[model samples]
Target: MNALSHKIIFFLFKLKLLQPSESTINFWLQSEDTDKLEYAVTQGNYKTRKLAAEALEQLAKPFSIPALLKCINDKVQNVSIACLNALERISTKDELIKTIVKKRFKWVNEIREKREKFEANKGKKYNIYRWERASKKSFDMVKERLKRPIR
Candidate 1:
């Protein structure tokens, strides 16, 4: 990796945002380095894993999608959120973004449907609790995202 790359990586590392060198990133993208890439995805520190996810999207490699998907369920919410945001950057790669959108839409729709069904079955009486609170929080996030100024 060049000095600039190292500096950037180090800065992000300090921020707990990324790990791995640029060349190491390229090496992970190479076919023969699949094992290393997979290991990096699983064993890398949060930043490294984040970088790996971004690299996979940049490389437009379909093989890395599964790993990226796994990141969506990561223990760290930041990692999972970053993985979702990276999916938007990778959306230009044919099925990549479409697949993620489809899955997320399905999940959101299922949640909405279930919520509606429950509300209907309950009939007239209204109670607010965990699931409703979570749903409201999710709606607020969506609203916030929608209201974001176009970059």
Candidate 2:
């Protein structure tokens, strides 16, 4: 979009005349503007913020670290997870976030291992209960981390 159109949208958005839309997230993703993507991370709705976080992760811009760090505390579980994943990708120097990412990957790998061993090997009954419990446990652990700001 032209600069004038963007300015108009920002004006309307600031006046509370327009709700944040997924289209704006798409715009930021396509434009690859780190500042605008950061704004979306800070200001967009839950779903919009989630998409913006994923987009920033894909872009992997170093400057977006501060914005992603702030977004990791979003009230929405998915948004917080998305921000955490983005930080995992963008902040290589942060050992703590990297460790968290490793833990998350371990949980995922364990789930896949269980599925393969039970379902693929013996063709036995799928243990949906166990999978659900493990999934929830992992989710709650991540959610607990979301309750506080990441350093």
Candidate 3:
């Protein structure tokens, strides 16, 4: 699309009148306007947030990483998934580790550990493995990706 059309669409999106499709997000991702993308990711509705996450996957600016990390704990599942996909797409092993350390999983890990300890002490041995397993898996995937040369 032409610049004018792109601007109009972006304006509409900002007004919350338009829900961005993947193509619209792809167009925006290629734009130089990082602020708009960052704003949408942080404050927009679920659809916009998801689109912003998708855009971030392609753009992958270091400044956008923290915003993307915040989205991982979004109340909306799709938004969270999109953020995760973006993180996986953009982050190197070291970057992923840094993000993990920075977030500390925002109390998620602490909660899991407490729960596990409580369950173990109670002799029930709760099997809530997914939480820790997913974190480990993400780290492992990043490590594996780091071993390969980017095409």
Candidate 4:
């Protein structure tokens, strides 16, 4: 391609107006253009996102960990699954991604549906075993205090 067209395409990438093909995404990955791959994981159509996630999984680069974490909740189940697979692969293949997952995303170990369910309920109040807010200690004004310590 001509330099002018390449510059125009690079501009489009910056704008995220271009719907990249799998090859284009692969090229970006090979060239270590992680910003583009991260964008692809979060922005592109389901197919593009799936492919990008798969590529990231194969690459298993630590920097892609945060992007893959964000993509794990993709509305498309397949894409989310791809994101999960990528995260698992990354955790296994890269120590940094692994440490981050263990420290911050332990729930990623759950199955996708279960993870989503857990995440959904994470903020809700539930009456499980021993689940109660501590009540403030109160005193009755009319109640007389013990005169002295009990023998």
Candidate 5:
């Protein structure tokens, strides 16, 4: 599709005027033009990048994991947060652990620890209050960092 058409579709999708059918997502997942989706994830406007990450999460194909990983470094905090949230949902435990070991992403260790704890507690009900508290603390720290003046 042409650039204008792509923009219109993205706009409609963002506005909720166009709900992507499974086939549409599948098409993007399999098409050679997958680069377009990757480009949007990495280089599109903030809103577009957010939407693309969301779509990748919903599609949840393994191939999209790398793109999602890269998006974690987006300059925009919200875009990075969105990508992180999507990664949590779509990445396997092994992949998350691997990422934790390989990348210095914020909260990667916390995410790995929570995943390990969740696995250990499987088949038994467990309160995640501690995890929630830690996550909130991390988010607050990030917010504070963002507010500070850069050297």
Candidate 6:
């Protein structure tokens, strides 16, 4: 983090300046250096990525999807949430959304099932049963309704 970058991060954090215009966001989105923008997506700083994610909605070109998907692995929960929102902004078709949702459902199901088992072992209910059910539904939908294109 450079001095100027640190200053901007601090200022944005302290003032709760959460939204930036499309052009201001483009400054970062279009820059040769993506380190700062990548950092914002992964830093666990909600307000920063909250702004960046909104900007991502507008700055999206073909190159943005993979980078935005990378955010889903962020250690911060909110960053992952923001990445999902950003995906929604970029996805145009039901299939693309469905594909991503299917992937997310797989992840959520694996995680939630393990957590649920752990909770059950400890004689407690889990917080994610609803999500587990939804994941199952999505999985079924993908398996049954998502027919492959005819050759």
lDDT per model, in order?
0.64, 0.77, 0.75, 0.73, 0.67, 0.61
Off by over 4 Å in 5: 1-4, 7-34, 95-151
- For residues 40-120, write the lDDT of model 4, one tens digit per residue: 788888998998898888787878988998987777878877887788776776676567545434454456569789899
lDDT of 3: 0.75
Clashes of 6: 0
TM-score per candidate, chains pooled: 0.41, 0.58, 0.54, 0.55, 0.45, 0.41
Give the clash count for model 5.
0
Query: Highest lDDT: which candidate?
Result: 2
lDDT of 1 by residue, 29-142 (tens): 653444445546666787767666666665655565666677776776455556666565656566756777568656656867998899888867666565557888899999
What's the C-alpha lDDT at position 150 in model 5? 100
Can you write out model 5's per-residue Cα lDDT over 26-120, one digit (the tens) per residue? 45655534555665687667876776677676666667778888888788766777787777776666665456535645465666688899898
Write one digit per residue (lDDT tens) for candidate 2, span 1-151.
Answer: 6656766775676676764566665676777877877877888778778888998999998888889878766777678778888988888997876886677656656866997787777855665654457888999999999999978
Give lDDT for model 6: 0.61
The Cα error of candidate 1 at residue 46, in Å, is: 0.5
**Greater-TM-score candidate between 3 and 4:** 4
Model 3 C-alpha RMSD to native: 21.5
Q: How many clashes show up per model? A: 3, 0, 0, 0, 0, 0
Full candidate order by lDDT, most accurate first: 2, 3, 4, 5, 1, 6
Model 3 lDDT tens row, 1-151: 7767777877887787876565666677777567778778887888889888888877877678788878888887678777877776667665654576447444555767897888879965566655567888999999999999999
Q: Pairing residues by index, what is the TM-score of model 6?
A: 0.41
How would you encode candidate 6's per-residue C-alpha lDDT over 1-151 as one tens digit per residue? 3446644754574465643333444566665335445545544256666666656655554456777777766665555666777777677664776588568757866877998888879976567644447888889889886687756
Error of 3 at 10 (Å): 2.1
Q: Weakest 10 consecutive residues, lDDT, candidate 4? A: 135-144
